[model samples]
Target: MKKQFFCAAAAALAMISAAPAQAQPQTQDDPYQWLENIEGEKALDWVRAQNARSQEALEADPRFAPMYEEALSVLTSKARLALGSIHNGYVYNFWQDDEHVRGVWRRASVESYRAGAPEWETLVDVDALAEEEDRNWVWGGVDCLSPDYTHCMVELSDGGSDAAFWREFDSSDKAFVEGGFYIPEGKSSVAWLGPDTLLVGADTGEGSLTTSGYPRTVRRLARDAALDEAPVLYEGEETDVAVAAAVEQDNGGAHVFVVRSPSFFESEYYYARSEDDALGDLEKLPLPMNADFEGVLGGRAIFLLREEWTYDGETYESGAVIAYGLAGAEAQTVMTPAANQSVEDVEIGKSGLVISYLEDVSGKAARFTPRKKGGWKRKEIGLPDNGVIEIISAGGGTDDAMLSFESLTRPEALYYAPARGKLKKIAETPAFYDATGVVVEQRFATSADGTKVPYFIMGLDSVLKQGNAPTVQYGYGGFLIPILPVYYEDPARPQHGALAGLMWVKRGGVLVLSNIRGGGEYGPKWHQAALKENRQRAFDDFIAISEDLIETGVTSPEKLGAIGRSNGGLLMGAMLTQRPDLYAAIDCGVPLFDMKRYNKLLAGASWMGEYGDPDIPEEWAYISKYSPYQNLKAGEPYPKVLFYTSTKDDRVHPGHARKAAAKMDGLGYDFFYYENIEGGHGGTANQDQLAYRTALEYAYFARMLMPRSE
Candidate 1:
């Protein structure tokens, strides 16, 4: 799996505690409240029963086995490109396959990696480590020291949970350092201050964490000192979400900084006075509370604004990139997007900054150089049009960087761009499935409020022309996360839509990706438009897209299906209760069903900034309008939805899905439910498990939406 944020572990801590006082009133009224006891005996029994029923029904289908095999082949194919980040003089990657179930940390020289035939040298084999330690060890990631990049800290999770243990490792010897810096299992953040020192934020003892269960104190620890003996560097309020410390290194210089997140969307930043300055006496950086500190580039601190800011009598709009000198507070605008564009990401190079932005939801990138006189200059990087471009690796003590590009019909291709040269293709992934006759088109649907929502449709021209083809529309319209088009190869990423093409579109089904409101497609304003009371706008936008598809003759009510997970799973729930007559099947994965009690669940309290607090009567008044569990009415023509969640999902509680299914059962509605014993919020632990779960989803859609000939 990719590196998950330490805040995930902090969120998981809520699972062990009782629900907040705000939920006490509803607890008595809920008959299924006992199901919230995640690992209780009775709860496991109920989960097992539902899992068996779901597996027996879906796996028994004639199409399940073949689809599973096809998915497995694509997942474990050796022809897939092994992408990695450039560090020191080598490219580092963590790889897993059928043979190595747990994966391995390996490295190769930049020349060899760029040559397309990397000669990999294994640093740590997780499967072997798991066997030796007698634990189900899952690879988290490694944070290496800059410059030489010899000493590092490796993270390991148990059973794919968010909580993990950290240990010091020696890259030169390819082994765990004996009697070196180590942090016991917890949701912790650690960064190297020096070879023998680290800035840490972890569970020190009682009262060390915030109300949201994240570390509220940052400490400076010496290599030879015990964790409890470490000196406190900085401390935040108990109401804060989290406090983290980091050391940013680049060609310009190295700087130490601390961040205090009071909520999911707001933060306060502090910087050390000098390299050798005391951490406890840091100076605060004067910047907007709703801005993200990107990094230090060329002696300037880069920031991406989430809200409009007025600094030095100059206004910087939201979604703009601005920079200030590390030694001074004067800010200058680096880049700003057009009305239809949003800056997606920013990365520091050796001497310049590389930015990835979206124009009308299409990906574009450029390099910004600081002019000798004053302002900055921009040079557009040439890339394939109508596709998503991502910065794979950058700012690893070099001016050269690597990027990847892909689209619905186009396979992924990696490119290497040097400081002074053009982009050269270094590697390309072979198409997993044939797309000779595939047609990709962008369309717009007028939403309930007359807003134009853009979406992508992929299918065979002949099949779409015939009309009424089995189709599945997917969306996630929250957290400012923009859904883009790409051919997915990594099971760990999960955001790619290529798997749909192989498993559904190649089999004569249509695929639709919705770019609705509450996304970063057009910038922060797009997301703010759907916050709190206006959250229904996102649901309305999705429903409008589905209706437009039917009206265009791409699919009918009986031939249409919908899929979403996590926040998107909440979208699935809204669709189920509000527009049951429009969809034939619903795949709701790890969803939040009972909105009234969502804030009491794991990590749900942290998202009150996005979804209003139900405890407040004023907010609940609007939330109650579309709370799926509260709105499900009897005698309604609802589709048979398949609900899947993980028992180890420390983020979203499994009870959300379980109670939803149980209520449907009580209402005489039939639905499918599956709960994996492992896997965190992702719902799968490894490639095989991912393939099996994916196959089950496709099979369920086939049974519900595809026509049968007897």
Candidate 2:
């Protein structure tokens, strides 16, 4: 595995060196210098200045007005809102941007009757959440709600190389659930045993390894609430095991431990109760499964694995019936939607479970019931395909389940689906997002390889097709992360000018979402078609989609633009380097540009299973061929490119974006760079901070791609 990793990196490096040299331009200060020298206040100050300037330019653009008005209308409309389930009765939702708090995190009543009714009350003032605690702890990676939903865990760092716990939130009162422990600077991952049972694992001190490096012990939160009394539940060789999943099973008493080896292709599990007298005896379970596993669903282990046969080339889950009492072994084949279709969330209830499978046959969600004869009985739930479904559990008491649905043009509609019945309106998500002038539809385009690619297009119905009309195309074809409909009515969408698209669509502009390979638009097959050496297929598919727009007279290359973040950034990067002639503007944010050094960098090492090892001689030949950073050339008429990242982005190192920008500058490519000092993977940690960055991106797109009416 290690050898394969470095081989991929080597391949990437070879690709970089293989490129012909460009005529070096006049030397400028090394952009990477700030990365090494800049400290706290100074780094943040730089981010603020750049944002201020970008905002000023965007707000000043004359074309920004109408888009802003439309954006504001959709953002504040009452017809767009929903009550989504996050933890039992405590829901999760993003209210209107025009709210007094910018955006409120509120909890709502699951049985509220009228849609758009004021049933939710604020939980945490986001502004206060950011100010009172460090952003990294509160806004990093993903957060999990406790089984009881009484407390929330936050991962934090103290400026050392690694991360540690900074704070905890009391979910009941929506306040800080404080036990105060200044974990060593490098310590990370604070898992809760129960509501008050805390388990911290990591190295300690500024850089010193914790005893034997890595988090070797799972410490228990003591009865006295003191750090010293926190005894080690499991440590040493046992800690090396990767806990793929842990659930409160055995009647919400015993915790089942499905531990796994580090390999992406295997799974070895064992379960034990917290109160078990022999807690150390973790007996292995007899199950034919792979390392690629999903979390437990309906008290059953749900996961996808492939056969050893090379012909398999697919990821198939064992489904929700995997671990059920007598029904588990029978096995049910739950639908794995197209690679681009998201996995519909599974809601567990006592009456029966509602498993919403995404992108099955169509983009819409499908429902399933565990059958007496092995597999599940499937039924299509006719919800809009353009939007996503968020299932709200009624805590197993009520027969009715609430749904939060939204799309780009439709806003958000909160509905209640009572046990195998029709959907009734409850409330909109935004409670103020206007849908009076909205339209959305799914479109298909033929790829360069004759493959039919799917896409979701959104715009105002009043707009007419014009050749010169601006268009913004979006895509992300990696990790099977579906690009579901975004109900954000921001005026700063690409087609309109950062804020130009929202307003431009009202006049005439289009938003096209390319359902290319590397995404689950069709399912595992769609993604596998573009895996490893075939990565370029996704880019080719995207290019073909863009050409389709031009052929149909919807928009031309001169007025066309593109946007993608992270893996999608990688796509746009390849597009800019491989087909710069096809786009007028591009927004590449937090991208993995330097494929060669990606593994060595933060979190990049883990994704080798997706993108072949750069170190591998064979894989390098193909990977380097399309690697955006290494493939860049000089004296070429490259499209205007904007590269964005965050200094605190501990995942895909900011260096990826920084180094790419530096290379672009040295090669004299028409490019711009912006770096945020906070917000881990995301450019910002706070919603308002995110809004500011979003506005900046839209503004840049508007400035470069939005055609001037004058």
Candidate 3:
């Protein structure tokens, strides 16, 4: 469950001006800096040329067409479950397939949804709306008012960009409310205060945004008032990352909050008495700046701490969940994980709080109810071991909640856990592929620093014993994000490994998921161990896993392939330059390659806390060691890597991939490059595009790693 009161520091910005050439020391030295012009005609022409050349090469492979068809079937199959959240008495869901390319916002009653044959009501057909408006509108989400849930703010993005336009929609009438609350296209945050009032943070014109290009001022606006006429509730510094407002409705009452994010990981929260109350005089919550505000439950403000806090001689350890009364100063610890556990998520329920945590990289969930006197009691939810459990719905003005569970070889099952009843399975997804001989094992690799890095390996038992099977490994060792095992093809849960199971494992291949140091596998300390100067630890951990695989005779360097994206793409870059001979293929997608100028790129500055500032020489000394573009040599005999990115990706600039490929080309190296004309950071807009991209990746792996018929 997403937190109701929080502002994202890396919220997408409006139109960004290119950083001056003088700002980057490498700009003058790099010959392909012209690729930095994201929408430049010359740059786009180069992109198109590269796309055509690579598409022809990859598509010509005999395996391409079959793999594409298989991927499309898996992606568009109606057998896939439609996941949703419970709002009011309805289960709201957004679905897309071959027919509804853009998708549709629909809903059904909770009873019907649980029974499997839901009589779904299409509230909005995004494809029809997009065609009528002549805009490639992508559904972001809908923020609805609590209790009745009749009115909502529907977020629509053009070309799947993070920056979106919002319009008020009336679910009762199944149409956009005429003259209702509407916000023009920009990265904005809005929450419902009432049917006729809103708390918004968005691009309001010049001087209304921060230097990072996000809204620094949060305002309260009336239904028919112009944006400029809205009353300023709170204003933050331009140097801050962003500011936003949120309102949480519970049985106790509605709680309004103003969140100010100064950096990527720090935030200040203020509470307002009412929607029309002046936030300038709002009471500041007594919480750690690095703590995350989970939600308000039982008249208490719940917080998850990122760092240890000693308040009133009471020391609360880092990663502990605590609660404090909104009107009282006293606080109580709700729950704390053991050494082998880390809190992954916190969900507020109508009667209690549900905590989802990772125990030794496996998922565990429990319910915590506050005691009448003080403290809290925990009741472990009876869930299957060795599976990932996620809270699907909670705190919808009722004690009823839903949870979903799945594992690498197991199909997903949704359980309905009422406030006062036993957990019962309500729906189950049919297996997409056979797992007759498949087995999963948890193994650990010793890093350079002697840290045991855990990883999951899935394959046929007989195939593993034979040794030297073609293998592909995936890792995302940054941003405190943990990669768990699940059904990967489900668009709702893209991180799962199910696609690899169906496409590769069934074909006699091994799949590996590495839980390296810079992730939140074991909590804050595990991630902090690889911060800034120690960032190389993450790279070392990944390399250790690759070596461990070879040492175990699972696969040789000639049969090993590596895949990563975004920060993981950065990892792929490091892998390519630091140890190109370790793997046969590297698929770097929507990556951050040019560390020297990443800070000046889109949303790059917001991540300085994760990756140190490259502008500073002291920090550059360490960053340059792994900066792929800087480390690429003319005659390194590097593996022919396939680089893919999205032209509309407003988060990580597409230039990172374009320039990296160009530099490699100039160095007399062979590589493949493809940039989607649409999509965003995800690199694909809909199922068809996703299927094609997945097929391309798998085909590349097969071409490079599989044994040839000589």
The digit string of per-residue lDDT tens for model 3 on 536-610 reads 999999999999999999999999989988888999999999999899999898999999888787777767777
What TM-score does prediction 2 earn? 0.78
RMSD of 1: 2.6
Candidate 1 local lDDT, 1-710, one digit each (tens): 01122122223222213333214443666787777777879988999999999899999888889889878877877777788888888989888878877899999999998888889999999999999999988877788888778999998878776667889999999999999989887777788887888988888888787776668888889989999789888899998777888788756345888888787778888987435534436878888888888888877889989899988899999989999787778899999888899998898887898899999888898999899998999998898899988888887888788888888888889988888887889998898888888898999999999999999999988899998999999888887877788786446333355677788888889989899998888999998889889999999999999999999999999999999888888899999999999999999998888899887776677677788889999999999998898998799989999999988776777889988998899899999999988887778777888889989999999889884461
Residue 73, model 2, lDDT: 55
lDDT of each: 0.83, 0.55, 0.83
Q: Model 3: residues >4 Å from true position, as ranges?
A: 1-26, 275-280, 489-495
Tell me which of candidates 1 and 2 scores higher on TM-score.
Answer: 1
- What's model 3's overall lDDT? 0.83
Candidate 2 lDDT at 694 equals: 60
Q: TM-score for every candidate vs. truth?
A: 0.96, 0.78, 0.96
Local lDDT at 39 for model 1: 83
